[model samples]
Target: MSAVGPLDAALTVPAPAVVEPGAYARLRELVAGGGAVALTGAGMSTASGIPDYRGPDGTRRVQPMQHGEFVGSAAARQRYWARAYVGWTRFASARPNPAHRAVADLERLGLVRHVITQNVDGLHQQAGSHRVLELHGTLDRVVCLDCGEVTTRDQVQEWLADANPGFLVAVDATSPVRPDGDVALPEAQVQAFRPPLCLVCGRDRLKPDVVFFGGSVDKGVVERAYTFVEQARVLLVLGSSLQVMSGYRFVRRAAREGIPVAVVTRGGTRGDAETTVGVDALVGDVLPALVADLRG
Candidate 1:
């Protein structure tokens, strides 16, 4: 698992330097020499119509739902289910962007060894990446709070549709969608909405099997990421600010191992101190360009 250990707390990262796109070519050269392990963040999916959790300045605009809140309160669960029900259309419809496709192609070209993403969105897998490790859990599955029976979110979505037919149309579809399939809604409406309960137990809660802000990642997942890191010749970070250290710690480990760490993201990263080369350009644009340059 990850040498970074389980995520314990958030870190205070300074605003990162934004450099001109002078190093993308060099980044490609480094990867061409040896395959790199990618640790991706939310920014990788911004091109796929998904909003990032933070802005360029590295500050979150909105507070995400907390694990304790979701588990402790019925109202919190209702609010999450309602926003998720509406946001599922946008989230599910998002296709893999060029960055995702480029990552998959790089692996095919023997330049990428593995992909570990902080994003719950399955864009990387959708783009045909086989060796993917989701650092945070995915939204595609929901788990029972009592019996831990994991069920597909698509199946849950269908049940939701049957239970709440016109509710989706009633809510404004365009309301800002969050990174985790949550849309902003008035508190009253959220509380008023009825969400589905566990089918197996009949009276228990069902939660998306994701590592919430206040939750911990599965240790087994972290260990597998560590194994990937140990085998990688280099570490590549794409589209993440690295505000949290779960992703950053791998970069630190790579640095400790004396391997090169290449970064291609828009904003400041906590791992900037350890980065060997960084390209502050749009990842979608840079990744495709990297692939094309490799072709020549």
Candidate 2:
């Protein structure tokens, strides 16, 4: 395959699929024959009460904790755990929304063959999408950096509660939780909190089983995502701006392979130039309509 030009270079970028009746029909036609792969991001879960890192304009709303900062400094880890512990309940309580369910429906009807998601929330699986590849590891598990032992997030939450009694009650519950399950808190509160230790090794080196910002995904998982895109009849982007290259690369690959690329998102994305069709609408509405039209 020939190398596609850079996103900003002089190229024939498709006109933005501004929200219109025709855009929906065009989207339906693209995925109507099935064999599409859904590449999802944080917007896919926004309807489930989880806030994405960016806004509709593709601007960053909150900065996430970088992997190096979390791993290299004990103080940083303490701050993270303090916030995460406070935000855990809200994050864990989020459920799959209509958009997620529609994706599952598409899979059930054989419209979507695979799902490659940048989200760590595991909403796809909860929505009944069986062939999901979580490019970023899920937040339900904890890994020990020192001993390489694994444990569940629920167990770690219990350990944290035992280690710091009445800590959760003291924090301001009104503070909004970030998509990564972090909440802002006073410095004093963070200092008073304690991080969870590994269940197997009993050391204070446990981290959530997720790829933090500035972290590389596991190579094997990336390869699998690439393989899926390569074989897909169409690449369907749901709710992602594709600003980050991790998800955008797959769009690039699909475009290079001459596969149809359709984007159903709320705002502008980095992959506009390569898209075969772009739908600027809420995924919650578009997906269900697409599924209905195709199913009929």
Candidate 3:
């Protein structure tokens, strides 16, 4: 493969210095000497067409909905499902790109011991990474609000379609595609699509099994991830901005423990000051190069 240029060479050239050509050599040395952990974020999957939540042209490409709106208003829920029903296929259809596969390869080579990811897309697992901890929940599954039953998102969509025949037709006919949902349809037209209830308990309330902006990650999940970090000699961060604490805390913990940190991502990161090595490059391009250099 051809070498790709730095993602933000203008910003990366001066700070902390570009990830030294020898950084991968050093990482390999550490891995050969002991175990290593990977802390991944949304950037890992951006090449696969899953937009970053906060990118300049991301989900906000359209309007954004708040957590309170989704939880409090029946109309809001209907609108969310209406849009999701159309976009769900696209989101679900996203495949793991080279970056994801590279991480899995690193694990198979014994260079990566654990993967802690903030993305709810489940791309790591799709990429064949076995020992992964999802800091945020996955969108592939849905959880019941009242009964705690979990179901595949496909099933929920089917139920929703059955519950609201011609409802999607209305949105398809008039709603404008927005990151939040179809806003072009009249409010009443959009509100006509009702989400299905939990199948196990027959309650008409189910939510995606993911942590929204204002939601907290499950404590057990966080503890398990910390345990993975505790066992590693180095922490590798890829494709993350570390904007949210859910993913940022691990970087903080690693810094506090004096673990050597290597970051590979596009644009700026919150943990740049804390990282021992920072590579401002696209993961799809840089990860394979770094892994190859490590092998040599």
Index of the highest-lDDT prediction: 2
- How would you order the candidates by TM-score, starting with the best? 2, 1, 3
lDDT of 1 by residue, 125-242 (tens): 9999998999999999999988888899999988888888788878887797887788998887786678987888875489998998889888999999988987888899999988
**Per-model TM values vs. the true structure:** 0.91, 0.93, 0.82
TM-score winner: 2
Q: Alpha carbon lDDT of residue 191, candidate 2?
A: 94
Per-candidate Cα lDDT values, in order, are: 0.83, 0.87, 0.73
Model 3 local distance difference test score? 0.73
Question: What's the number of clashes in each of the models?
Answer: 5, 0, 1
Candidate 2 lDDT tens digits, 258-281: 999999998899999998888888
Query: Between candidates 1 and 3, which one is better according to TM-score?
Result: 1
RMSD of each predicted structure: 8.0, 6.9, 6.3
lDDT of 3 by residue, 1-296 (tens): 12222232222222223455555444444544437799998789878877666662222343455667777776666677767776676677789999999898788777788999888788899999999988878877888778899989888888878887876555554333342222345566666666677668986667788777677789999999998987788899988888778888989999999898888787778887898877666788777655554444
Question: Is 2 or 3 the stronger prediction by TM-score?
Answer: 2
| lDDT: worst 10-residue window of model 3 | 8-17
